[model samples]
Target chain A: MKRFSLNQATTRHWPLPDLVAGCAEAGVTGAGLWREDVQAYGVERAAALIRDAGMTVTSLCRGGFFQQSGWEEENRRAIDEAATLGAPALVLVSGGLPAGSRDIDAARAHVGEAIGRLVPYALDAGVQLAVEPLHPMFASDRCVVASLRQALDLAAPYPAETVGVVVDTYHLWWDDGVWDQIARAGRERRIACFQVADWVTPLPAGVLLGRGLPGTGCVELRRFREAVDAAGYTGPIEVEVFAEEVWARPGADVLREALAGYRSHVAELPAPVEEDDRAP
Target chain B: MKRFSLNQATTRHWPLPDLVAGCAEAGVTGAGLWREDVQAYGVERAAALIRDAGMTVTSLCRGGFFQQSGWEEENRRAIDEAATLGAPALVLVSGGLPAGSRDIDAARAHVGEAIGRLVPYALDAGVQLAVEPLHPMFASDRCVVASLRQALDLAAPYPAETVGVVVDTYHLWWDDGVWDQIARAGRERRIACFQVADWVTPLPAGVLLGRGLPGTGCVELRRFREAVDAAGYTGPIEVEVFAEEVWARPGADVLREALAGYRSHVAELPAPVEEDDRAP
Candidate 1:
């Protein structure tokens, strides 16, 4: 499908050029990239490679971490990088409670203010600062924005075009209120990016790299795809997985499996719809 | 303090007699017991030990896992055990999705039904079925009830005395709405058991353990204690940490630290209060 995207984190070991070539060879046209990976490969060169392959950079992995020092200058550069790559959305994983500071409410309030500071710059740069609410387990150390409601609340102060919320199934699959939040996000026009990852058990050490490839775990993948589709988000559906096991495999093999899993698990519709002729 | 409680899971390896002796020697009056440890030590004997030591079993560690095949029988026994121990609340960790089942809504609805079915028996047994919402990280394999709001909702439609909810700081600290929910639980008289545990970083594998004692992590424990207090809950404050590091130390040492942590991090009120002549 034209909307399918391979988030670079899914194939974390894959070289940028090789990933681009592999996607190109496989007729894939969209990608979700990480800041660190793109920077390592030289932003301009990576942009060129993807451009030459006629692929769209659906989103850039991050831009928030407001808790850290020098966040302003760093986020500005991230916005610049996203602009160069032609990515419309810069996903923001709002960093957790500032070191040793136990006040989560204060940390979260700071994130709102921090985002307000960046809204003007983001609007001018023509990039949507996509606030991604990570899984709650990361609330203490990695990301404080742990629910779709929080993300929407954070984005409410800014214009919908300038700021939006990401709907990553991995982070939100367990939430009973998430379905309603997704609908609310749709009503608010805040859904910027939709990512898919299955939740598997026996979470390894660090609790970071234990995600399952689509269809491999107990997540309702197709339901999420359908919900996002119904939410007026007709953009790229990025299959982003972060697991040591998935990364240990050959990049090409992992890519193939990712594509295959997306096809069998996420791409199918509940009932066949009339084919659209919008694509030229 | 009159409200302090030591949850047995904090010192998992501590023998029943030694733990009871340790608590008695330390002048602790309340405890939260685990089903396995009680069964392993002989329930009647354990009950007699705690009863003779002049300590109260504040609450029982569990009684939910509705997804399992023998759950009804298992839970009935758990209720009986709580009755035997004279514990007022039987905390339920609503089981995760059924095998190969991706529909979480169905699983959660089943939990509601399961709790409803047990309401009459719980009432007859003079034990409150306290529905505990585990952290979202355990939503897949351990517990699907992931928020205080959800737990309260499930406990709704039943009598407040028969069904209530557990408010554990570790499971609910990440939720911004929890403060309001804690207030709500107070309004509805659903605050059956109030628990305290700090959320530390780099969670161990399986994540069943890895909780920190109060003041060790970023959670605002005193704030939670104050919230519950404001919510009109004057119940036992159970210190329930389940980390390997905490368990490795001698039970007496851990108990002292837990008591000390609770004293410094949880018991000390922000404002001085009039002494209660209510305690005879």
Candidate 2:
């Protein structure tokens, strides 16, 4: 059976314990927890609660804002937190163009160097660093990784077992090469996670947190799923709807709606025609 | 000694002839005239006015909406209008995702096939089709051509003299591979037109018109110019600010501000570096 995971941000209104319990009630086998939620409740406590609730922690929300000058220590500590939470993956949104740095290449390099240093720690902690490419609108003030190819390239030298890429529809719906990239990532064994969110409104900050639920927009979710499934990825299909309006509603209602949307929209994707066809 | 090209949309408050005369009076040597402006004044009258004023038509606003089922005739006619205006290039914004068609790949193929049919006509008419990649925010509702690399790849198999890409900063400000792509376009001799506008507020369909003047926001205009020059591009830098707010101001004032900002910002860029240097 296909598995569903609710990213905690979808229900930021609910406490982590409640969210986990809610996911269990909704029959979702997994959950993607946010760093702030874990931090607020304490990582160890949140981990205990989630485990007791018997839910899969698909991925930890994030840990990568290394564009600033003195961020190495901060990043290392984040690695520790990810390990403590027992997350299978630690999603990293490389910080935006650094403050006062016109050289985006430099900012990107700073992120690369930071990732290089943090990888060993992540490997030690049994946490995979999943690089998440944000929408291009966030290039200036949020993240510099803006495409799957770039993300895959950044993770190239790193061990695939320790570093992978997260495929989120909202951020990647526009890329011409996204389909091919998904197939390549699958063949390379680097798809760490798959996420769903619709791109409807364009925010200045880019992360409007008002992402539409799947099928509410034009993203070919079914085609996208087929591409990932073809790539031999059988991971939790995490629904991380960042809609501010949607979150304003009751968490239980939102979960119910998300589940319905996921089934009607994402679940119908035809599995790829061939399996193990990625043979060299 | 850099030249300023007033995009008619910049002085949308003023009529076309008045804007042309204004450009002449202000020592702005070039202008990007829009289709509506040309159509209202009649192409013959508009062309004569531009020629008599001794001003160059940098480019005609656009000529491509190749997503629909039967758009070839309409597209061909737009190409004809571009040719009649004596504009050196016709900026082609590949239209939005077709309704009910979730297949972006198919949509892209349709765009390519449409362009393929139109290329010979463009070449014969002495006009290059300039493909402009809009910001990803408009990926669904506007242009599907959202990356310079994607645009370049689309234009690659075509003749550089027949087809090229428009480097518009406002639409592409947030792109990660910008400098590299700009440099590549320059090397390929496909950098047909240069445009500038700053991304300020969030993009609502209506507020997307709120682009900033050249020096207004955080865009590294100087760095961009350096990158373009380094790639051996010596084309006129057209100030194409699409600010609804600026248009609400007096037309003359917007032109004056754009002129002053362009001179100040363009002056700070480094002298042309190696056109092929990958590193800044």
Evaluated with DockQ, which candidate comes out highest?
A: 1
- What overall lDDT goes with each candidate model? 0.93, 0.81
How many clashes show up per model? 0, 4
- Give the Å shift of residue A109 in candidate 2: 0.5
Model 2 segments more than 4 A misplaced: A201-207, A268-280, B68-70, B173-180, B201-207, B230-232, B267-280
Q: How far is candidate 1 from the true structure (C-alpha RMSD, Å)?
A: 3.6
Give the runs in model 1 whose Cα sits over 4 Å from its true position.
Answer: A270-280, B270-280
lDDT of 1 by residue, A140-246 (tens): 88899999999999999889999999999999999988889999999999999999999999898789999999999999999998888788888999989999989
lDDT of 2 by residue, A1-280 (tens): 2478888888878877678777788787788988887888988888888888887789987888777666777767777877887788889989876655566777878778888998888888888999999887777767888889889989988999899999998899888789999999998899999998876644433346658887777887767777899999998888888867887998888889888878878885456767567655
lDDT of 2 by residue, B154-219 (tens): 899899998899998877766767888998998889988988887664544433576788777767
Alpha carbon deviation, residue B207, candidate 1 (Å): 1.2
Candidate 1 CAPRI level:
high
**Every model's TM-score:** 0.96, 0.89
The CAPRI-style docking tier of model 2 reads acceptable
Per-residue lDDT of A40 in model 1: 100
